[model samples]
Target: MQRRRLLQSAALALCPAACEKKRRSPLPFATLADLTSMIQAEQTTPLLLVEHFLERIAQIDRSGPRVNSILELNPEAKTIATTCKPGLLHGLPVLIKDNIETADAMQTTAGSLALRGHKPKRDAALVTRLREAGAVILGKTNLSEWANIRSPNSTSGWSARGGLTRNPHRLTHSASGSSSGSAAAVAAGLAPAAIGTETNGSIVSPASACGIVGFKPTVGLINGAGIIPITHHQDTAGPLTLTVRDAELLMQVLAENFTATPLPDILIGARLGVLRTQSGKHPQVLALFEATLQKLRDAGTIIVDLVELPNAREAGALAWKALLIELRADLNAYLEQRGGDVRSLAELIAFNEQHRDTEMPHFGQEFFAQAEQLGTPEIIAAGQEARKLAMQLAGPEGIDAALKAHDLDALICPTNDPVGLIDLKSGDTNERVASTPAAVAGYPHLTVPMGFVDGLPVGFSFIGTANDDAHILALGHHFEQLTQARRAPAFSAG
Candidate 1:
């Protein structure tokens, strides 16, 4: 067991008056057990603990890596702390992907300068559950501008309002979007945990970029209300955390239907599919994926490597098109309710045109143009065809048919390549990942840390059908316990 070491340098000790108060430990950060114990002992109130996190937010976020991934900070965090209890998460602080909303003072910018001042009128239903579970809604983290669907050239974590989010590993690599900020913050210890939504690989890809466990629940598991629009079929909020227990902790809060437990030996022995076709990730990542298969096989898992996924890329493209069309309608309706200004996507594009200095300094809204064209009858039919093909390729004919044909508990793949260079003008050029297929199916996928490459972390994704989220989470938990694959990075004291 990695005995959670406490590194209490003078730097960590440079806390606000809140963290500087008398304490047995001088450190600014604590482990999962440490946090749970602190809450259990009442040694520190949830309010004070949240204050510590906010202090860290002021200290490290955007200051160090200039990892400008956070779109906004929740101003009503203190107010949320006042209503805490013990049965639920009990005041653990968490970051929300910018696309999701809380009725806090923070503006939900979705990483675009166009909607800079839009405030969600009320908590998204999932935010309601987060509060009910006693978790502190810390703030909104930055994401790919429009969740990376706006433009293929869009930088993963570079938002006009938030700037570019730096990778925790090298400080120069891309933190894969569109859930870029959510993954970076949790890995950097900016928060104990965070929430992220996915239309494609948004959740798991970023989680892979910054070493953390990311869970995208079976579609509809977490309510999508108040989340800035994407494809409703695919988008849902899930947990990104340092440990499987923490991932389970957040999932329990978000879903009305899930219970966490380590799977039994018989369950571990269940057939597992080793996807052989995903050849896009790095060599180290492929090695890690193979290593993971070896671990499971050694434990008696019936590993099947010959499984086929002919529809993977085609389905992925379809899912992207579906997202664009859905985003147009969903966003326009969301904007209509706001009603005071910005009423349509056209207006938003116009606003960005007016402020192109901030929003388009690096890349143009080519995806927005693509989306704007989707509403036309010609493009609409093409979108319909894409949706049908996607459903056929990724859903019943792809992951489902393959998993069933092989009789597998879950399917594994390299989620994302290790950290790549951050390019604000060109965006993430070395991008490659395997989160698209499962994401398109609206199935649940859990990404646990696989291993590190060049001192950078990569992850393996375990994806399963919608309602079987618990099974995948349990399998991931087992792997996490067996391998324990994570190491905190040290700040370069140059």
Candidate 2:
């Protein structure tokens, strides 16, 4: 309460009239385009915008509802806001997942105590792009410890350094992660948008659970350097935002040579294949999916039903093996080059053991130990082979085959089950998700709000072939305009 008061005072000091109105309005929930227009109209300055968000973060995130999404605030945020020059995202503040690096006061620990004070020598490549595009590095958000790669039984949003990030829509429910905080913060209006990384469901699943838009671009589209590694083959950072256009704007800034070609009529005569096999078993979720299909049909899109990707199981298994192998190789190189006190995967495992009570309170580091064991030259070579085969099965032979056979522009499915109860002992109950095929194939996947089931939000996905991000975005943008499905979180207890 005292913190909230201080933030309120800060807002009033920043801009008396605007702050008073902002306090009573839904400015926190405003879209990027809305904020940009306000900035251009001289209604709000960058400093004032930062102060307003700081107040929101204090009121709900820390005190009132206690969403616990942000891990740390960028101490220099106000200063940067005042000085940042005009660009596409001028004056916008964006929260980043804890796994991504920022050369600032905030630590990029990936929500682990192992690297509690670790700071990168420079910002991650995407962070650099965001700064160049005139965005304020608002803070680092809590994430599943080590991107939910530690244990099979680990909770989705619980992390040693940042604790658990709860769903803003329902406090008791899970904020599906490893991008939990990023999604939740945006949903709760702590920030307009946030950056989340995905090797698989990290971005889209959480966005689905939080009622927002999550876009995972083709893996190589965005630079992966300086981020804490998972697997270079499938890892990429993308935007989690209130709208698909916001995601597209960030993508333009993050991915070089990328341009947003507005296709207001792209949905007309478009062929979208429905991946029924990937849709979950929830009755209401399925019903909502069917309703969404009908809405697309009404919008002149041709829906191809029962279009399933081939060899998904085989591709997933292969990708798992490859990720385990690559985790060791990729992480070792990153930690060594970063010059951290804990410098290798082996040392990181030992650090967890040393801090077992805090770091392993909910689950163990079995995945890290397994990766460490698979570190032979021959095994590494075999893992590379597995990665190659997995890409083939998931990409050319899977998503590509399905699209070609149906002459589809993209594929569609449910992004995830509804937000579940947060169970630390049992871990995440996300048994069914549509993130794998596109994730393994290193293709573009975008999830927008479909509708709600008993007050909990679900997502509709658009999966396209590699480098087909623009078309996929166009489809999502059109759907977003058609349905206007996204609603601001009510911060209710369910």
Q: Top TM-score: which candidate number?
A: 2
TM-score of 2: 0.96
TM-score of 1: 0.90
Cα RMSD, each candidate = 5.7, 3.4
**Candidate 1 global lDDT:** 0.76
Extract clashing residue pairs from model 1.
69-142, 150-367, 173-420
Q: Taking the tens digit of each residue's C-alpha lDDT, what string does model 1 give over 30-146? A: 655568777677566676677777777777775755556566777788777767655567777778888776777888768777666667788888888887777788888988877
**Clashing pairs for predicted structure model 2, backbone only:** none
**Candidate 2 lDDT by residue in tens digits, 1-494:** 45755885897899888767754443878988888888897677777789889999999989998999999999999889878978999999999999998888889888988787768899999999999989998989999999999999899988999998999999999999999999999999999999999999999999999999999999989999878989999899999999999999999999965788898778899999999889978999999989988988998999999997899999999999899999999999988998767999999999999989989987899999999999999999999999999999999999999999999999999988887799998888865778999999999999999999888889999999989998899899999999999998888876
